[model samples]
Target: MARRKTREEIKTQDKWNIEKMYPDNASAEKDLKESVSDAEKYGKYKGHLADSAESLADALIESDRIEQKLERAFVYSRMKLDEDNRAAEQQALYSKAAAAISQVSSLTSFVMPELIRIPEETLKQFIEDEPRLQTYRHLLDSAMRQKDHVLSEKEENILAQLGEVLSAPDQVFTMLNDADMKFGKIKDEEGKETELTHGNYISFMRSQNRQVRKDAYTHCYEAYKGMINTISANYSANVKTDVISARLRNYPSARAAALSSGRIPESVYDNLIDSVHSALPKMYEYVKLRKKLLGLDELKMYDIYVPLVKLPKKKIRFQQAVEIGKEGLAPLGDAYLQQFQKGIDSRWIDIYETEGKTSGAYSFGSYDSDPYVLMNFDSTLEDVFTLVHEMGHSMNSWLTRKTQPYVYGGHSIFTAEVASTVNETLLMKHLLKTESDPEMKKYILNMYLDAFKGTLFRQTMFAEFEKKTHEYAENGGGLTADWMNKTYDELNTEYFGPALSHDDYIQYEWARIPHFYNSFYVYQYATGYSAANAIADRILNGGEKERDDYLKFLSLGSSDYPVELLKVAGVDMSQREPVDRAMKVFSGLVDEFAELMEE
Candidate 1:
């Protein structure tokens, strides 16, 4: 077997291509100089946007041009640095670009507040006079919407200076988890011991041996327990940052600040929690049933991942995954199906797992390039699902970018997951319809059921935990390591009901989940899966109109708020219908799997 690439090798592999982002250090220095000069030029328009519609048009257009170019340059450089931070030279280049961007942001931050202060009539007149201003009407409206939240330019300066430090907790925690943390030893089924690390955790969880799974789970948490204090401190700092910023900006609460960025209503968060709380008994029932099927007297955290039926040991090759994914997605018609084929043919994916490569999967792109996917293939069924999942994200990006301008090219996280999950749903549906082997069909159905249980029920539990933790912190509860562990343990018991072993190390789970730092993010995984289930059902049911609307939703991007955009696709997350429908779908899957196991 080929050895995994060392971190050093991965860095060296990219050094030549990394220079393409900036040309060289000299080119980056030049761009910084030019960007600063453009900021000064754009800054001349503060408070004067109402002077004339045509002149306001000219100023706003120039501002966007400079902003877009400067942003692209910064993003490219930053992405390069992020790809491999072990190289000091790349890290230094990132710092240089960041400092310059910071300085430019300080010089230009007052323009929006100043523009909003202009009289509405005057702004209207400018837009009426300049036909080109139509392109920016929405942009101008968004800035004005924050009129009440604007602070003095001096206060803005102070906030701008504090940006890096305010963001330090999330940054530091990511580096600590991704680059530094090392859990010691785990024994496999063969009675041999190996070093355990973050990347290997998934492989171990997929191990068929029940004992191996338990050992990995408990040992991983044991290592995390040693560092829980530092992790808790980091979590507390991140939550406090949200609270402080929300108050400083005069938002109603930290939740408001977080949700408003995605243009989500606070009630959406509240409704998700409320509905999930109401449905907890159903979730608890599912858990107990899972434990019963596993034939365990009492389950533990490690038992959650093992399939209710052990899947046949079938290894799926990387190329086979591509073909199956293409065939599975063919129901969307040839044009859409061909994109998957093109993605594979064009090498838009970086396939194969290597050392130091990022774990998990994601699709990313620059405005100038086609979206690219990164994956770690291990020939397992889950790895195949991951391919379809990430392709869902890539295809969404491809469709949106091809259809929309740069300003509207990206959707919020609220809608982003809908695309990915829709693809996964369609893929699973395709396999279920065609497969002939009973055991294989059962295996596929079980995987699909697991997806719903994990994404919908499990993540809602996470969302509730997030909400209560934030509320606790907001109401003066200190987020000590014990508090974090205790709260998590309570939630584990509540969500899992009496299915789990009480003595298990479920309390340490919070220390391992990276999403806690993101505050209110995990819930979207649940909500997104719900919405995707509804929309994908519509598309698969021969609803031409519904399919068209969903395609339009993909292209809508940030042109509207997420709720309104979703409404166009005929799913309103504001109501609990989507969640209820999704849960029923999940129950049906559980029933199917239960019947299969009985056979």
Candidate 2:
């Protein structure tokens, strides 16, 4: 049996094979030099772009080519570091590539503002006059879309220069959390011990012993308590970054600015939060019943993940997880299913748990090749869900690339989670029906309910917290630790209701969530889950037309904004219907589970 790997072993595995990115150090150096030369070429075209339509088209094409190369280098470097964090050489290479990207961005920043300055009618004429320029019409239109937010070149340069320092809060927190922090051993009921680290916390939380779950939660927070102030400062700085950026861009609020990035309307955010809020009573009822099922005197956060039903010793190996995933996804039709099988056969997935291996799971790739998924498999129920989730991302990339051009190959993050979560919903439904064992069916149902609660309700709470903080900062409210805790505590009370006690340590959760620092981002997880559940229902059970619509949505890439794409996918998130439908699903699950328990 393969046990967890040590950091040293992981580093030695040559797991990433980053040379596949650039061939060797020499090739990387050559690319770096070529990119710098490309930067110079783009720089020369900056102010002189009004020569002619064809000239403008050629210049824009060259700039995109330069960007594509730089992007590839960055992807390769970043993936290497993720594969094995302890590799010094790969880290150094990533650093170099990062610096190169910054340099390239600075050189090309002049392109957009200058393009926006061109009269819209004149630009349209350019497109009409030059057939070659039509290919770039969307790119030009997107640049023009930001005309309201564009600043003078000098102001933009100042923001660029401040980027590193401004982003310090997130950077310092990442270093402290991912690299430094450590929690001591957690002792289970039988006295067996496991070291508590970020990567292993999930595994420990699933422990059968109630004491083990409580200890892991307490110890993990205890470790974070000492660094609470530092984390708080980091979060506050992030809030401030959004405020300052939004103010500079002349936006009404930071939330507006973030939504505008993907052309999302603020109504989408509000609708999701409002819809989820109305459904909290159902969620609370589920929790109360869960506590009763566990036979606990009172419920704490630690009780959430304990299995409601136990299977009779089914051990899903990492390989078996892949097979199950492929089988579960096969209903999407043969083309979608075949690529996933190819992904498994090609070893596109880096499977198994090892010390220092990255925690969580993700699928990432450039337009250059097949997508790769990184997972630390512990053969647990959640791991299977994660496999399906990441595969959703990978398969989305695969299908999108096949159907769209290189420029539009990637979809926005707003819609990305829907693809992943939809796969998970389908997988759970498939499992519930196919598994004849009553216990297994119940377990699968529990898993499905847990997904909705965790992904939708929990994340919406974070989203509400995020929106409040941004508004507070934008309105001249201080982002001090005290302010954050007070705001978060109130939101917790509102969402969780009075049945359960809100602990002081829960306040520190705002400090620990990495997503907040990324700004106005967590809400997508909530919205996406809702959107996915609705869309997945149609795709799975609504027959041929729904399936074709879903495939078209996947193939959309960036052809339209997220809202437009989702509308085509049969979920108009701009309206509140999807949110209401999803919450209704949550309520239905609670009712069904409660009835089953009564029987």
Candidate number of the best TM-score = 2
Question: What are the C-alpha RMSDs, in order, of all predicted structures?
Answer: 2.8, 2.3
Clash count for each candidate, listed in order shown? 1, 2
lDDT of each: 0.75, 0.78
Query: TM-scores of all models?
Result: 0.92, 0.95
Residue 356's C-alpha lDDT in candidate 2? 49
The superposed Cα distance between candidate 2 and the true structure at residue 271, in angstroms, equals 0.7
Candidate 1 residue lDDT tens string, 211-272: 88878887788878878899989988988887778789998778887787666887777776
List, residue by residue over 428-487, the lDDT tens digit for candidate 2.
Answer: 888977998766777777888888878898899999999888888777887877888888
Q: C-alpha displacement of 398 in model 1, angstroms?
A: 1.8
- Which candidate ranks first by lDDT, i.e. highest? 2
lDDT of 1 at 255: 80
